[model samples]
Target: MNAPSGASGYDAVVLGGGVAGCVLAARLSEDADRSVCMVEAGPDYGAEPRHWPHKVLNARALPRDDVWERHTAVHRIRARVLGGSSCINGCWNTWGSATDHEEWVRAGGPRWSASAMERHRLRAVEQMGLRAVPERELSLWARAALEAAEELGYGHVAMAAPGRPGFGTPLINAVDGVRWNAAFAYLDAARQRPNLTILSQTTVNRLDVRTGRVRGVELDVDGRRETVVADTYLVACGTFGSPALLLRSGIGPADHLREFGIRTEVDLTGVGANLSDQPGIFVPLAPTPDLNAALAAKEASGNLYVSRMLIRAASDLCPDSSWDLHILPSAGAPLFGSLPPGQYEAGISAFLMKPASRGHVRLRSADHSEPLDIDPAFSTDPDGHDIAVLRSGLEIVERMAVSAALKPLAGAAQGHPSRDLSDEEIRSRLGAYWHPVGTCAMGQDDDPWAVVDEEARVRGVSNLRVVDASILPTVPAANTQLPVLTVAEMLADALRTDGR
Candidate 1:
């Protein structure tokens, strides 16, 4: 309603300066003529890595700082920083199977094919400087896990690209001990460009979508309200944040918006529906004295990463050439809490990579600062397929525990082993892999569940697009960091090709 209060309008105003936002802002501004602005809810430590908080830059552990919610439900955890989850995740990069591309191609188009997306994936890998886990960085626990995978008949294969089910170390975006997040990898150099403007500590209140087009964006910066306009508005606020923003702007299910008395501009029910995320259960193991000592030494040398190697294992229910699980073995400082001086936590976690269950994200209210109602619905499928696949993955955990390579390092199950646990018990222990997607999934126009089209444009809304993990129709059977980066890169290419 009101004229934009501050700076002049931009060619593209990117909401949420997360991983995808960074890539889009950097790539779109490459034309030099197009002005781009990236707005983030949290602080940006500038372009210098040395200025960032050490806890955020440290690759060995997940820092609790710069998070949306703290000491709350683990399932709702997501970073609020400029670099997004990349600043707080495990710093590992792994690619999904070709089967994942088939699913995407079915929903979107051939552009999502493995071959079509390969160049984008490789570009993301190169831009981030991803490298395989060095021998010194692999803790003794990880080395033993590698041996156990080989002993179990899983032939070695790369983790950064698709291949038959196998075990190997993942490529990492970390250098030495520093976590090279998207901000550092993509935005650092872009900061030097005059065409790009990075706005930190700015929260998007809502989009002024009128006549099926975004008019302007209401923002809250340092408690001061203002409006910013752009020719094209790109929402890269991530899975949870993106849908929540749309809902606040009355772009979700009409019935739900009516409850909050917000006028609905679009009646799309898929804006926040079809939420998908990987659910995993950790089978804790009591480490041997030698294991703890080795881990301690690794910590002393700043190389103690909780996990480095993983096995892409096919569940019995999985297809022939695809894997449905990631068997992760880790031993080091606990992800959440600390241990006594030389002691540590050790375990093998079985992650249900390709799950069938779905969840939804809803607006708690119209307030921008209010957290969205997020339900992962982990293992809540009606037919119990997800629970069964997770159970099968746990079986792999049991076998990995008993292998000669791991049995000597980590003695036995410390508490109730996953194999002996009932379905309900296992569900109680379920932890998310921190990969949430499909909030604004892409699909054909005929699909009622589809929110966005193949080009990441929201249905029935012009001058608006969502370029982030939120646009993915399903969570890939891998950690989502690299995939998100690649998706951003591909969408940026699409924008460039169209000259929008």
Candidate 2:
């Protein structure tokens, strides 16, 4: 753990160094008049080996240099560093559609209108210096996938070009082709501000609430207890951590918190509710005998492109109803859980989009140091739309395999060569897509269960706010990196206006 060796005081404290947390600190300190403090429980990503762009050459799992590992009946991975998960995730970026924000507004999160979010989205791209890629300039595989879709009569997809939806190459948070995490984009710049102080390796054990208002927080610093006080504090600790913090502070489903002997500070039953994420239905393909030479292409020349293909299938198969299919070209050697060597050395993988089922993040115990229970509630919802989409994705991939463009490279299917794979078979094989969201939601009205309001202020509490993925009312149809960054940018400006 990277501990801060100094005492600090600031007008506000931004907890968690992920995309939202870093942005909160950076944006708040922009005026140079107010002081801000940002703390992360993880190590620094700058000195880590896994963060190297070229390190992709190594097929082995990146070493857990700066991340923290927690054990339970189920194993989970978390980055305990200045950059949070951004330090360890693959550089796949996705921005939400306009409809995404409209839904939020409808869900009671005012000021979250699609147009409002677009303003922030533009600022986020400018902050990161991201240039839009022309669809025609996309790599061969990407072009082929697009072409294949057209041939199969599913042609309305877009590329990574600006202002397009459905299928476009992702806009990575990579600077100069290297991963550009939140700490790099916002926090690192904020660290240079004289009024901003960053305390690393410090974990907040609980919030110190007094008289139904937030006073400060309690911390477990290197196994020692410490109390922190500030005029205002923000919990950017993420969906899982944010709710867990509330539970430890005696806020949550009343009965659940009481069982642990922690008196309820606020009975917010929705604290850990509305959890969700996207899962995939993978389709493996091998290069044709002629393209074996292409399989040996240099690492520098190979890149993976992720785009979605909306599939219309039986609604009965999927109840929650929203779904999309992901397409990625096989770059080189086999990935985790590879099959026999002769398998198509290069191919495409697909995933179900906009899953309908929801999951929950809950406390296994009230102990701050204990790991929180995570059900991710995957596929438990019978009303979910992903089950149908997964089956549809299987059929679509099979259709592409037979297309003139993909057929030459993918060849005739083997084993079950009849393009007749079952939905159950697809479900059995595909895995989660890694876009988890919406544990700590923000809304208006009398919903005490909502942790925060439209302006990002924590409900029932003053001088505190939450600026992270947890506040997302609905997960976007695409990647979350861009949206998370946008939220940070917007909040930064909002905080400035509020402070004035």
Candidate 3:
């Protein structure tokens, strides 16, 4: 657990070697003059493909084992490896719409605007080697689903491209058949740099803040306590972990800190507030004879089962903006343990991309090891806007299930056979897409609820910045991986330019 020989102090100590952490560590270390240390709470397999477990390397579906269980509502799944969630996510690379970043500008100013963020987005995409799945590789079930969506007047289902929104095969960050995670993409090339030190299996206890500046971090390395000092610190521990770190360090609301016997240091009320995520519902359909046969043939040939098609559409509620609903169609029921062994089902998961409902993440105790209380407060928007949009999406799914192109392939839906469920019923079955953000929201000065400023620096804490999904003012209309990477890249550029 001792420092990696000569690693007593560093120019920058990045906590949590996840998607954003890997990007920042790699980019910052490129200077060759700055000493960087990345501490990850999980195993680090280096850059070799052979070192990774089968689940981490598999690109077929998301691994469900590594997750933070949110009380009964949903399990917040995030990978605990060098690459972070990028190692086990759906591999969907989406940038959302221009309006998504425009809202960031409104909240955090022009620096985060779409035009300003384009270069970072491009850098991330190129580094990750993102590419659209070829049409020829589409599974039988996927083809039928796209055809049915178009027949139902959802327009031509094509592949998703940057700055464009429509129905298409989602671009993914996968190479061949392996998940091309951030560690493999970013950290691999920089692993040999002497200035960069990656400490695996190291959990951050809290930021060692004194007199308003973070001096170092107390860590739990294999149950042994240790301290690592740095001139500056970046918390990239993700949405759930980042804010929890701040709260445990007595940097949250003063009243909340008092209740846990921790003296307040910063008293930032917004540390764990304004939590938001996409709530989605699954519509399962039994596969038709033809679909089943195709699947069997493909299985026998050992062909890769790729299901990357998605539909982005605007509901009646938010017609003026970019699409607010994501219809993700899959060849098989990918949700872990959702179906029986031999059962083959094709389905679509509809997510309310831009939700109005908000929630919060609070500490159950001052203990850093204890899980935080995560309440997404799904479908609880006072105006009932979230539910209304979901209802419209449900109707669309029903129509697609019965369309001529898919009617023969899609049998009766598993849970709701009638599709005539009331709005209350829909709300009862709401679940999250697991894209949590905004816990440590970035906003302009004078905003009491803003935990961080446009530069991603913690409002009242000096030499400490949070660069992760937690800083996103609002969840984008697409999957969070690409957006989070872009933010990290931009922040790294800013830090480098500042010569910190």
TM-score of each: 0.98, 0.85, 0.95
Worst 10-residue lDDT window, candidate 3: 156-165
Output the TM-score of candidate 2: 0.85
Per-prediction backbone clash count: 0, 16, 1
Local accuracy of candidate 1 as per-residue lDDT tens digits, 1-500: 12235746899999988899999998999999998888899888988888999999988889888999889889899889998999989898999998899999999999999999999999999999999888899888888899999999999999999788999988999999999999999988888899888888888999999989999899997788888899999999999999999998989999999988889998898989999999999888999999999999999997888898999999888988999999999898888777899999999999999999999999988898887899999998999899899989989999999999999998776576677788899888899999999999999989998999999999989899999999999899999999999999999999988877
CA lDDT of every candidate: 0.91, 0.64, 0.82
Clash number for candidate 2: 16
Model 3 lDDT tens row, 143-257:
8877877786666533333444467776788766688999999998999999999999888898878889997798887787888899889999998899999998889999988
Stretches of candidate 3 above 4 Å error?
A: 1-7, 68-73, 156-165, 304-306, 319-321, 338-342, 414-419
Assess candidate 3 and give its TM-score to the true structure.
0.95
**Per-residue lDDT tens digits of candidate 2, residues 198-227?**
777788888888667877777778888766
Model 1 segments more than 4 A misplaced: 1-7
Root mean square deviation (Cα) for candidate 2: 4.2
